[model samples]
Target: MLLFVIDLLGRTGPFSETLPAGIQAVVAGSAQKAADFHVNPPPAAQCASCHAEHFQDWSRSSHARSLTSEGFLRTFPQYLDFVGIRAREDPQVSMACFNCHAPLLKNADSEIIRRVAAFVVAKDINKLDGFEVGCVACHAEGNGVFSGPIRNPKGNLFHASKFSASYKEASFCATCHTWAPASIPCSDVYSDWKKSRAAKQGTTCQACHMAERVGITAVGLPQRKIRSHIVPGGRSADLLQKAVALHLKAAFRQEHLEVTATVRNLTPHRVPDG
Candidate 1:
């Protein structure tokens, strides 16, 4: 029985391929159930619409592909294997993985929660997605924000009430926009800003990234006002490249053995450091 459970936990693979039957059923079915909670799908707000240019930049950025990505996932199996970590089988653990990758759903039931307990006992839990980060991943309704969608607050027609000053405050992003818990060493751009002079100036993640310079839709849709929904975190490869020019130059000690690394922070708090 112990070996059977171990094997069950070890069944992790690429997100593109079919997951284990049990996991598939739970993820797909539970995701649909969570969708049911939203009676109204968010309508295209100012920035809610797609912005090809911004998205292209963001798509090339690391923030867009935090975990739910192939390259990113490849590192995981090897990293966990190196540390002798096993995969988790508990539903709560599953939910937590989904929380960052597919935050649109939940598996908060007792039975599944117990699975989290069991998985914790086994100490083999793995993350849910590769390139797990996406546009709506962090800029969504969750993240403990009272505003509408975190990214395109204005364009999201469903949450008309969110068009307020509180949504624009930097504190609104402090929730999950920062770092992961101690167990996870994920970047925390939010906290960095909180500690910097920017925080004193009251500059927020949205002000710089999603700030409304002019009323324009992401896709150039003619709206009274467009919220910048092109959540470009990691996809802006060019911008990232430009930002890290100094680091790349510095790393190339001899331009031969130097590994030019370009780092781009999607958030202002940890802009390049992150």
Candidate 2:
């Protein structure tokens, strides 16, 4: 279930507050921005020069391999066929998958996305990583500005930054965690969380996935409470036991046997969500 992974970049709606107004259409594959529109953020490797720790965490994350993973390579074609499109038949037509897998294309022109799609059809990995979901894909906003949940968002102290309350909200993840139509509940974790008890308690997705820890913000930045980027999921064995539970009961009444099984999902969102 590669679709099992949460893809926040595909639907830049959550980050649109900091990006250009047309970025929403660009990332969603709904339309392209005008030629005058432009954006260029540093790559994960460049960001690593300053945010070594954050980069280390992200480099090992599934988010980093959202586009380059072997499983994705195999699954993507099947996914296209399942949806009635064939990459071999029309690579550009199936390019919509890039919306989720290679969201950083939001900064590049649609022509760049088309080229990446051709590379994907050729199974060319060398040219793909640059477009993968990386540091800039999430952190960088319109132009050089960045945004996060930090109070006062003192990014300008070193560079440029913007205060983003959304960084602390579940809706941010839902922008891509959600893909299916209203009638269908495919990869609809956001809707499941909405009706869950956790939403009522105000417990967000980040509360669990991005549990905060005291760590360095940058190479020389002061140590502070920062949300971890090492996002775990249902596939993580330890997390599985912690977030899910099962109960079984069997009863016999009037020479008949009855069995009852109950599952308790401790997380606010649904388990096996996708």
Candidate 3:
């Protein structure tokens, strides 16, 4: 029985392809049930207990409010309504929006899924508190392991720790920042960066968002400089000021007033990116 459980856990290579249709359904249903209930991982507060500064930084970031932001709260349910209307025509309509907004739902238990679905369907913006993108969404692996860019980290007693080069690279941000749905470019930030001189020069997303800082990563650990969690983007005033240059010239040509304004993009990619 132990070996059977191990085999089930290790079955990641398309086992459904070899199973009968009824058996496949049963297996899929069982897997979904397990995902919905058995995956009760800890909340973001657990991480805050050890990394208070990082937690505080993240709390003020837009990422912390990805799901609860007024703009997102207004449009998300309308999107769900559109999906519901079109779902009958194409039952396989993609629901990829949740990939970034509600990352937890990727492995949420059935009860959580039902509650979120109900809130979205009813447009109940008030009750959706814990559904936003949280710390574990980006740092934790599927098996409940926490990872970061720190190599040989110490003083961690909460969970297993490991160094992931991807955390320091641009491709990590590309997972969600670059996506095309139904051949329509929803977000092309990652691709834009790739085509820009920044990518050629080895500039990464973390270089701008998660800027370096000198501080302790955890309690009881020596103070070492590390990438900060106060990740910022286009909305950052300092970044916007540095990304573009504007100049205005006024003159009189042939007794007629002529004014010219010049705007130059200092950044590699287009400004005001979506």
Best-matching candidate per TM-score: 3
TM-score of each: 0.46, 0.71, 0.72
> Which 10-residue window of candidate 2 scores lowest in summed lDDT?
1-10
- Residue-by-residue lDDT tens digits, candidate 1, 82-123: 445343433444444445543433424544444433433343
lDDT of 3 at 182: 57
Report per-prediction Cα RMSD to one decimal: 13.4, 11.3, 10.9
Off by over 4 Å in 1: 1-67, 75-86, 107-166, 180-185, 211-222, 234-271
Looking at model 2, how many pairs of residues clash? 0
Candidate with top lDDT is 3
lDDT of each: 0.43, 0.63, 0.64
Q: Per-residue lDDT for 237-260 in model 3, tens only?
A: 987887889888999999999989
lDDT of 2 by residue, 1-274 (tens): 0111111222222332343333333333222221112223234654554566787888877788877777777766666666674444554555566666777665466566666666665678865755677776676675447787776754422247777888888888886777766533236678888998989999988887886888887656688987778787766777788777788999998898998999887977666653
Choose 1 or 3, whichever is better by TM-score: 3
